[model samples]
Target: MAKFQSLKEAVAENLRDGDTVAFEGFTHLIPHAAAHEAIRQGIKDLTLIRMTPDIIYDQMIGMGLAKKVVFSYAGNPGVGLLRRMRDAIENGWPRAIETEEHSHAAMANAYEAGAAGLPCAIFRGYRGAGLREVNPNIRSVTCPFTGEELAAVPAHRPDVAFIHAQKANRRGDVLIEGIVGVQKEAVLASKRSVVTVEEIVDDFDDLHPNLCILPHWTVTSIVEVPGGAHPSYTHGYYDRDNAAYLEWDRVSADRDLFTAWMKENVLDAGPEIFAARVKEL
Candidate 1:
C-alpha cells in the first residue's frame, strides 16, 4: 500500500496546514530532509509530536510552522537548549506556540498505547511531579484489579508521521537498523506515514527477519533520500554532523541569523544537497 514517491511529492500530498504531525526519530535517523521539504513547501500551524524534540523541531518552530508541540524533553541533544523553541515560547518572534510536556516513560507508553489502538496510556508515573498539577491530560485512573492509582495520558495518534530509515526494499518495506526508538510505534499509530530512506534495495534478503521492518502496508510513501538524515547519522551510511549541530546553536540563537540560515540552506536548497553533504563524511 506504500507508494514510492519523491520527497517533495510525498510531503505535498501527505502533509497539509494545521495537521498534527510527528517527525519521530531519536538521536539518530532524524528526518531532516523531509522536515526541510515541508518547510520549503510552507507547511504551517502543525501540532508537532515527538519524544525528544531536537534541532529539526527547532527549525520548524523557528519558521513559524508549529502551533503547538507535544513532547517529553526538548533540547539540542549534546549541545544545549533549543534557542528557537525558547524564542518562540518566550519572545514570540515568529508566533506564540503552546506546549504539552510529559515524562519520557509516559511518551513511550502513549505511543505504544496508540499503536495498540488504546484510548490512553496507563502507567505508574508523575509521582510527586508538578506536571500533574499543570497538564490536564495527566490524569489518574484507579486500577480495576487493585485499589492502587495510576497515571494516564492520551495516546499520540498523529495525522502523519515522518521517519528516516536505512533502506527500503522495492516492495516498500522499510528497514530501520540502529536505535529504532519509537519510530515503529509512531508509524503504526499514525493515520499516515512518510519514510525517507538512504537507498532502495532489491530486497532485504540477508537482513535478519527479527530486524525492525515496517511492512509496506503501514507506510503511505517511501522516498529514496540518500543522506536525508544529515546532522543526524544514519547507521552504516554516514556519521552525525556534530559540527553542524554546534553551528546551529549559534545560528539559532539569533532570529535574524536563524531566518537567514533557513533561507539559504533549506528554502534555496533541495533534497539533492543532502547527498552532497554526506559525501565527505
Candidate 2:
C-alpha cells in the first residue's frame, strides 16, 4: 500500500545508490520535485531511465547523481541542447557517465514488456535507425511463424520509478488526467515507486473515463507536492513554466551559474517552496 510520506523520507527509504531508477513523465507531470528531493538527499550512482530526458535529468546528471542514463531522445524541449548532459558526456564535468540509447518505440515496448513480466521486448523497429550500432542491447530475433526479422531489447525493469500526477485520493489511488505518457508502465515495471501529486483529494469525484489511475497497492509512497512538475505542466493545475525552461539554457551553460542556481533554488528549497513556485508560474 502507498504510505503518505515526505519526499525526503520516501527517497531515503525506497531509493538507493547504484539502483536503476526511472523518473518518467512526458511534457506533463514530470516529477521535478521528487528528482530534486533525490538530489537534496545526495543519492548517487543511479542508473537513470527516461524516454525524452529534459532539464530535470540534466540537473541530476550535473550533480553527479547518475552513472548511466537510458533514454531515446535527450534535449531541453523547445530550447537547445541539454548543456549539462553534454558536459558530462563530452567533458566529464562531475563524472563520466554511460548511456544506452534506443528509439521511442523500443523504449515504450521495453517498459510494457517489463510491466508484463517479460524478459525482453520484441518489436519491428531499428530498420534504418543507427541506434543499434551504438547500443549493443539492440538485437534481432526471428519470428517463429513468419520467419521475419524483428528487433529486440531488454525489458526496462527499474528498481524505482518516480512520477508526478494531478491527484491522489484519500484511498491513495493516483489520478493522471493529462497527456499520459509511459508513467503507468514505468511504475508497474519497477520494484518500487514514488509519486508526487498536486493534492490529496477526498475522492476522484468527476474524473473522466480516459484518465489513468494506479491503485494504492502499486505505489510505495506518495508525497503531496504542489507544482511538483514545474516547467512541465500538470493537466488541471497549472501552465508550463516556459520562462524557466528558456532560462535553463543560459543557467546550465555556465558551470558556476548552474551549481549556484541548484544550490539556491533546488538544494536549499523544500515542499513549501515548490508550492510557491506553482503559484508564481
Candidate 3:
C-alpha cells in the first residue's frame, strides 16, 4: 500500500462525515492539529471522542463540524468555557452524549480490547459514580468469570485516530515521552491512524527505543510539519502558549466571537498563518 505523503492528505483521506474519531492529547499537548485542518477543509458531522475537549474541539463544534462528542469534559483550551457545547445542549442542536469523567479510562480500556480483538474488558473503578449516571454508554454487568459486578467496557473501534508527536519517521513511527495512556489505545483501536510531528527524523534508531510510542507499522500516514502543535506544546520542543489559552478562555464566552477568531486564525489560515498569529500574541 502507498503510504500517505502528507499529514493534511492523511487526515483528508481517513476522516469522513459522521465518522467516530479519537483525538489524542491532554489540555495542550500533542493535539490533533491536522484533524482540525481536515475539518477546515470541509469534513463535517464528526463524532469526536476524547478524554477532554479543548479549543480545537470547541472550534469544530462551533463551526458545526461535529455531530456528536463523547468526552469527559468540554471547555476552553484550559479554563472552563463550553460556549458551543452548552449551546448545542441547550438548543438540542446535535446529538450530545455526555460520559463520566472516568469515561476516559473506560474508553481507553475499550480501545485496548478492540486492539486485542476481544469482545470486551472488565475493570473495576468508580462503580456507581456520578459519571455512570451521566454516561449511559457504559454498562454494569455481572462478571462472567467471578460472578461479581463489573464494568464491562465495550470495544471502541474508531474510524480514525489523530495525534501529534514530538518526532516521527516518514513511515509513521512516533516518538513521545511520558505516559501515553489512552493515546496508545486510540491508535490501536482505530482502523486508520494519522499523526502530525514537529519533525521527521531520518531514522527511528536516533531516539531511545522505549521512547517510541506508536510504531510505523500501525500508522497509516506521517506528515512533517514544523511547529505543528502551536499553542499546544510538544514537550521538549516548546512550551504551551498559556497566554493564548487564557485569551481563548476569555473570549470563548461568546460563541460568535470565538467562532470568528477560530475562522480567522485556524480555519482560514494554515500552519504558517497560525504561526504568525501566535507570535503576535
Per-model TM-score versus the true fold: 0.99, 0.98, 0.88
**29-116 in candidate 3: lDDT tens per residue?**
4554685686578787777887777777766776777777777666665466777677776764344533334566676677789788
lDDT (Cα, 0-100) at 108 in candidate 1: 98
Q: Kindly provide the TM-score of model 2 when superposed on the true structure, using C-alpha atoms.
A: 0.98
Ten contiguous residues minimizing lDDT sum, candidate 2: 272-281
Local distance difference test scores for all models:
0.95, 0.93, 0.70
- In the range 73-137, model 1's lDDT, one tens digit per residue, is 99999999999999999988699999999999999999999999999999999999999999999
Model 1 / residue 206 / CA error / Å: 1.2
- lDDT of model number 2: 0.93
* Cα misplacement distance, residue 28 of candidate 2 (Å): 0.7
User: In candidate 1, which residue pairs get closer than 3 Å at backbone N, Cα or C atoms, i.e. clash?
Assistant: none
Q: Candidate 1 vs candidate 3: which has greater TM-score?
A: 1
* Candidate 3: residue pairs that collide: none
Ranking by lDDT: 1, 2, 3
Worst 10 residues of 3 by lDDT: 92-101
Which residue ranges in model 2 land beyond 4 Å of their true spot? none
Candidate 3 local lDDT, residue 24:
73
- Candidate 1 Cα misplacement greater than 4 A, ranges: none
